[model samples]
Target: MKLLIIEDEKDLSDSIRQYLALEQYTCEVAYEFESALDKICLNEYACIILDITLPNGSGLEILKELKRQGKEDGVLIVSARNSPDDKIVGLNLGADDYLSKPFHLPELGARVAAIIRRKSFSGQNQIVIDHLTLDIRDKTLKNNEEAVPLTRKEYELLLYFVSNKNRVVTKEAIVTHLWGDDVDMADNYDFIYSHIKNLRRKLAEAGCPEYIKAVYGMGYKFSIPS
Candidate 1:
């Protein structure tokens, strides 16, 4: 999933970004309020890790703006302020969860997964599509009760496709979603093609139907035939 981390502590933000990246999440960091606002206004994220105390403004203001825009992005407040009032205000302002400072990265990751599950997958740990089943927690994919091994990139690609089923996702969008800000430095999108091809081949070999379709020069779309 794609995540926006709005934090002022550079070390903390870098740690969170690195840990989440290892967990196969595309994470973007903004250390100040304006940068965070700019990102929130421009991109679509599955979840946001917001800090209440930002360098320029309160993260709560950003939350309010998001709510005003009718955005349903999942938000988790990660702040050093552990007061009851702060927690109440954040929750009332549309934050999905709160984690205090000095928290374990694993716990934070778990909270992110839980919020995503509730918001996008109806709180289910397993996502089933036709004969294919994916265990979100364990990061496993199976077809008709048989395990299908997938590379890390392949698994991320499949998850991204499933989450955005039927949408006309562009090559640029896919690259941004998969690599986040790093896509800007990539030489080309040839790696994306290779990952998609490998994923399709594995799924097809596992007896799954071809669900990923190239949109010519645009990108790809994932959907079951009607």
Candidate 2:
């Protein structure tokens, strides 16, 4: 899953990123409100870890903007205060969950996972389509009864494709989702082509159907006809 950490504390953000990286999540960080807003407006995310206090603006304002835009991205509010009003307001503004500072990293990770599941999978941990079964909690993909071995990037690619099934996903979207802000510095997205190629090869070798389609001059689409 992809997450955006909108936190002012660099140390806390880094720690969160490091911990979540072990869980195979793609993380991007923004320690200020403007940067966070830039990212929020530009890209899509599975979940956003938003701090109530920011240097330039209140994170509550960010939550309000999200609601105003009718964005469906799951949000987990992180605040040091234990104020009930804050929690109530955040929840009222469509924040999925609230977390106090000095929290356990594992618990935070679990909450993020749960929110992603709730929003994307209708509270289910696994997604089944056609002959393929994807266990999000276990990070496993199976073609019928046979398991498909995929690298971390390949697995993430597949999940991204599944999340936007039947839609033409642009190369820029793929690069930003996989590499985060680093795509600005990178020259080309050839690596994405490689990942897609490898994932397709592995899935086909495992006898799965050809579901990923490349849209001419646009990008790629992962679709299955009814």
Candidate 3:
């Protein structure tokens, strides 16, 4: 999933970004309010980690703007403020969860996962498509009674495709989502083909029907024929 971290504290922001990145999440950061607003306007994020206090503007304004635009992205308010009023105001303004400063990074990660689950998966722990079953908490994929082994990238690619099943996903979008901003300067997207090919082969070998389809020169789509 893609995440936006709107934090003015450089150290804390960096820590969160790095930790989340290790968990296979694409994360971007804005140290100030304007940059954060620009990113929100430019990209679609699964969630936004917002700090109530900003140097130039309040994070509450950003939350309001997101709501005004009908953006469904999850918002988690992270602030040093610990007052009950602050929590109430944030939740009322559409924040999914609140995290105080000095919180554990793992706890923040768990909260983000919970919010995404609530938003995208209807609070379910497993996602089922055809004969394939994906365990979200354990990060495992099963076909029938057996486990299917997938590399980290392969697993992430599968989840991405399933989450956006039946929609054509551009190679650029997949690369950016998997590799983050560092993929911008890549020479070609051949690596994407390689990963997709491997994932397809693996799934097929495990007795799963081929669900990934190439859209000519466009992109790829995941679908199970009805």
Question: Candidate 3's residue-wise lDDT over 1-226, tens digit each?
Answer: 7889999999999999999988778798899989988888766777899999998999999998898888989999999999999999999989999999889999999999999888877888899877878987788899876899998889889888977888999998888777765777789999999999999999889877879999998999998775
Off by over 4 Å in 2: none
Model 2, residue 69: displacement in angstroms? Answer: 2.0
Q: Pairing residues by index, what is the TM-score of model 2?
A: 0.96
In candidate 1, stretches whose alpha carbon ends up further than 4 angstroms from where it belongs are none
TM-score of each: 0.93, 0.96, 0.92
Task: Write model 2 residue lDDT over 1-226, tens digit each, in one string.
Answer: 7899999999999999999989999899999999988888887899999999999998998888888788999999999979999999999999999999889999999999999999988899889887789999999999887888999989999999988889999999998888786678878888899999999998888777898999999999998787
User: Against the unseen true structure, what C-alpha lDDT does each candidate score?
Assistant: 0.91, 0.91, 0.88
After superposition of all CA atoms, the RMSD between model 3 and the true structure is 1.7
Report the number of clashing residue pairs per model: 0, 0, 0
**TM-score, prediction 3:** 0.92
Give the Å shift of residue 77 in candidate 3.
Answer: 0.7
Error of 1 at 38 (Å): 1.1
**Model 1 vs. true fold: TM:** 0.93
**Which one wins by lDDT: 2 or 3?**
2
- Which candidate number would show the highest TM-score if scored against the true structure? 2
